[model samples]
Target: MSEIHGSYDMGPSVLSPENVAPKTAEVQDLERILRGEISAVEAYKQVLEKYSTYENANSLRRILVEHEKAVDFWKKQLRSQESFVEESSGPWGTVVETFVGAAKLFGDGPTLRALKEGEEHGLNEYQDLIENGNVNFESESFIKTICLDQQRLHIATLDSLIMMNKV
Candidate 1:
């Protein structure tokens, strides 16, 4: 075998080891958000099933669809980056489930209020991510779009709560 020559100068590193740590952290953050969306979807379904005959049941179903869409979008984004999306929502999910269970005891109005609060919490998380300025351009764009959708969902939930109060 021939002896090696001078040190090979590789071109610029696209994803150097130093660059990876921040990216990995960002991915983990996104995965956390994705898990939250998954829990939200499940929570909405549980509420829908619990109050199938409630006057605003159909509206709840529509909101569930929106949450499902958010889940799908997050999944697509994570997959695009070859990131592993966490399947479970972790401890916070358990807390959400417990809260939802308690809210059910109070009937449809309380359930809707709980859901509205959840959406607001999710919106705040996204906003925080955007404010942190650590995400890549693609992730930033996706988060902004998600934030807008979440804002709409929050408003819709508020409207539903108002109407429920009227009834």
Candidate 2:
């Protein structure tokens, strides 16, 4: 009901940095996962472009869309609480970009494997977030359902794609 700035203020406040809710480990982890989703979208786009002619392009694109949705969900949460959304994917994103870029040289097999690896990393991250008992993030159901489902689906899809390519 309130304006974005009226309800949430991410700017430097009169209070010290430590007092900010956004600095909490849970928010930090949420932002990290959000950034990872952004990075996943980027990687998917790159791999999709490289393999546009492949028969399973739509499946790959579906996974990309799922990642994008996760990014949007996190961004909305940050907007409500943290009052800021990350534009860049941050440190791990840089690593993903570099890994995918290099994998392109080796062709479809490596690229698909690279994408699967990324999904595995994401799955592990989500699990870690849920396992952190110190912070019982309310959206754990969403993490388990949508987030984990998409990651596992991507992994399985990529696995099938990888095996298909081998033939």
Candidate 3:
């Protein structure tokens, strides 16, 4: 099994994948952004591996790069600042895990549709985060921008699913 700390030496911890659902609205917003970062990163990797065309591959790569960078930026912000409350249940985490399971029982189109739906849910969660003062103004702005970018990518993925699967 893979290690949680991004290393092989650490034994795989049985910790439940984090849910970014915060109790407070502000913290909830940050959690949604955090969860998006996680989901986009994973989807980026999956798309990169699953597709072959230069255009499609590069599209996924760009999305992955941006989201990965955002993840790094948020991690840094979390380290430097205070006031954000972390969450235990996040839409991104749950959706991605659910997608993994769905892949087994559903066609690629269905799976992609499910992921797109999850992405939409995640976008809504982030919206709630922003409207609720779940984060500072600057942090909120930054995460909101990232969430928007993820939305565009999610839309693209949805289109790709329809094109590929006739869905």
Candidate 4:
């Protein structure tokens, strides 16, 4: 119901130089992961749009929609929390943008493979972030479960696509 800001503003104090100091590598990784989630959703959308006429268009669309849902969930949570920090240098966005451009140039086969690889990288990143003590972010178990599923599904999807000569 409320308008979403990129991050919650508890007060100006939170933005003070000392309070907003650079984050540790682990926290930076969490920020990167969050950015990657958004990027993945964007990449998936680009893929669905690019391959709307492909044989498995509907499946692609389903995956893209699901990813969009996940992106929104994380964005909403990050915006709601006061302590959420934005990265000074956003590597995830660059990575996603490059992948999307590649997807646009290549056909569905290679694009999907690239996406699967990205998802695999994301899975490892999320696992590492979850294990990092500096981040200490607590999300719903459902989110964790969904992240795990995305990782596994990406691997399976890549394997099936390769086997079927779809990608």
TM-score-wise, the better of 1 and 2 is 2
Most accurate candidate by TM-score:
2
lDDT of each: 0.74, 0.82, 0.60, 0.64
Candidate 4 residue pairs that clash:
none
Q: Candidate 2 lDDT, tens digit per residue, 81-107? A: 644567779898889999999999898
TM-score, predicted candidate 4 vs. hidden true structure: 0.69
How many residue pairs clash in all the candidates, one count each? Answer: 0, 0, 8, 0
Candidate 4 lDDT trough over 10 residues, lowest sum: 80-89
* Residue 4 in model 2: lDDT: 59
Instruction: Residues 81-156, candidate 4: write the lDDT tens digits.
Output: 4336443326766777687677668665677778778778877876766676444345535347787786778678
Superior candidate under lDDT, 1 versus 4: 1
Highest lDDT: give the candidate number. Answer: 2
Candidate ranking under TM-score, highest first, comes to 2, 1, 4, 3
Query: Where is the poorest 10-residue window by lDDT in model 2?
Result: 13-22
Write candidate 3's Cα lDDT for 6-43 as tens digits: 54665434322253223555444455567667776775
Q: Work out the TM-score per prediction.
A: 0.76, 0.83, 0.61, 0.69
